[model samples]
Target: MTARHVLLLGPLLMLLGAAYLLPFLGVMRWSVTLPEPGFGQYHAALSDPLVLGVIWRTVRICAVVTVIAVAAAYALTLIWVRGGRTARTLVELCIMIPFWISVLTRAFGWLALLSNKGIINGWLQSLGFLSEPLTLVRNEFGVVVGMVHFLIPFAAFPLATAMRSVDERVLLAARGMGASRTRIFWQIFLPMTKNGVLGAALLVFVFALGFFVTPAILGGGRSVMVAELIYLRIFQSPDWGLGAAISVILMVTVGLLLGVMMRQNRGAAR
Candidate 1:
C-alpha cells in the first residue's frame, strides 16, 4: 500500500474505532459505578443464577443455531454452485428473499406454524400422527427454530461467496484421479472453504447471541436469553447499572469469541 492510501485509511480507522469504543467505555463506566459504585453490578451479574442461566441459554441456543445454519448453508452452497443457471437463480432468490422481510414478521410466521392450533399440529392431528399438540412454540424448540430461520441466510451468503471462488476444474481433476466423492469433498472442498465456514459461523453465533425479538415473541417468558434479560433490567427493573453490566459482559464474550476466531484463521493461513 502507498503512503497516500495509509493517510486516507488512518482517519477512517480512527473514526470506526471511536464509533465502537465510546459506547463500550460508557457501558463499562456505568456497569461498575452505577447504582452506587465499585463492581457490585458485575458481582450481581456473575452471581445471579437467573442471569447466568440466561447467558448459558443464549450461548447454547446460538451454538445450535450456528451449527444448523452453517451445515445447511454449506449443503445449499454446494447445490447452488453445481446447479444449472435456472436452478441457481431460484435457490439464490429463495436464500436472499428472507433478508428483505422483517424479523418480527418471520417470527410471527413461525408462531403460526408452530402454535398449538397452528398448521403443523392441525395437520398432524388430521393425519392421526398425534393426539395432541407437540409443544413446539413458547419453548426452547421455538426459540431455536426462529433463530435458525434468521441466521441461515447470513451463513449461506458467506459460504456461497466462498464456494463461488472454488476451482471446478480442481474438483474434477481430483475425481479423475480416482478420488471418491466423499473423499474429494472432505479432503479438497472442505479445506478450501474452511475459513469462510468458520467466519460465517462466528458471524451467525454473535448475531444470535444478541437476538431479542424472536426469542421474546417465541420463547415467551419461559426461555429467556441474555438480550431479553438486559431489556428487562433496563426497562422493567429500572436497573441501568445491571443492564450495563450485562451489556459489557455480552460485548466482552463476543469480543473474546471474535479474537479466538481471528487467531484460528491466522493459524490456518500460516
Candidate 2:
C-alpha cells in the first residue's frame, strides 16, 4: 500500500511476468498476428465444423468426467468420514497411489485393460458374456473411463477434508429425532459438504479440459478433444497460427469460468 513496499514488489512482479505472463502474452500475440495479421484465422478455425466439434466434444467429455468425479468423491468422502480407522487408511492409500503414478503411466495401463485383446475383453469372453471382443479401446468410452479415473482423486481429497470438519453432534441430534440414514445424509451431511464439492468439481473440470495423454491413448484419434486438436495443428500439420489462436481461445474460456466460480463463491460468502 506504500511506495517502498510497492517498489519491493517490482522485482518479484517482473520475475513472474518473465516466467509466466510473458509467454502467455507471446501466445496471444501469435494468435492475433500470425497468418498475415488479422482475425481471419480465428474466424477460419471457428467456422470449421471439425474444430467446432472438437471444442464441443472436449466440453462434453469434461462435464461427464466432472459429474462422475464429484459423485464418486461424495461417496468416498462419506465412507472416510464415517468408517473406522482402517477404512480411512485404505482410502488414503488409494488416493496416494494414484498421486504417485504419472499420467502417461496410468493411460498406458488403461490401454492394456481396454484393448481388443485386453484383460477385460478376455475375461468377458471367457465368461460367455460375448462371443467376440466388444469394442472398448480407441473410442469415447475408453477415454471417459481414463479421464474419470484421473479426476476422482482430485475431487475426493478436498471433500474428505471438509467431511472431517463436520460436527457429529448435529448428526446425533438428527438420529435422536429418528431420521433415517439416507434422509440424514441428504438433508444434513451433504449440504455441509457443498462448498468442498463445488471447489473439487471446478478444479477437476478445468484440469480435465487440458488433458492430453489419456484421451490420446484411449481415443486413438477418433475422439479428438480440443487439446489434442491443438497438438495436431502445431505438431502434425505445422499450423502455428491456428494452434496459437485455439490456445488463446482455450485460455480465455478457462479464465472466464474461473472468474464466474470465484464470483459465485464470494456471493455465497456474503
lDDT of 2 by residue, 50-92 (tens): 8999999999999998998889878877777788899988987
Worst 10 residues of 1 by lDDT: 261-270
**Which segments of model 2 are wrong by more than 4 Å?**
1-15, 264-270
lDDT per model, in order? 0.90, 0.88
Model 1, C-alpha of 80: deviation from truth (Å): 1.5
lDDT of 1 at 39: 95
Model 1: per-residue lDDT, tens digit, 25-48? Answer: 988898988988899999999999
By TM-score, who's the top model here? Answer: 2
User: Residue pairs in steric clash, candidate 2?
Assistant: none
Q: How well does candidate 2 score on lDDT at residue 223?
A: 92
Q: Against the correct fold, how does model 1 do in TM-score?
A: 0.89
Per-candidate TM vs. native? 0.89, 0.92
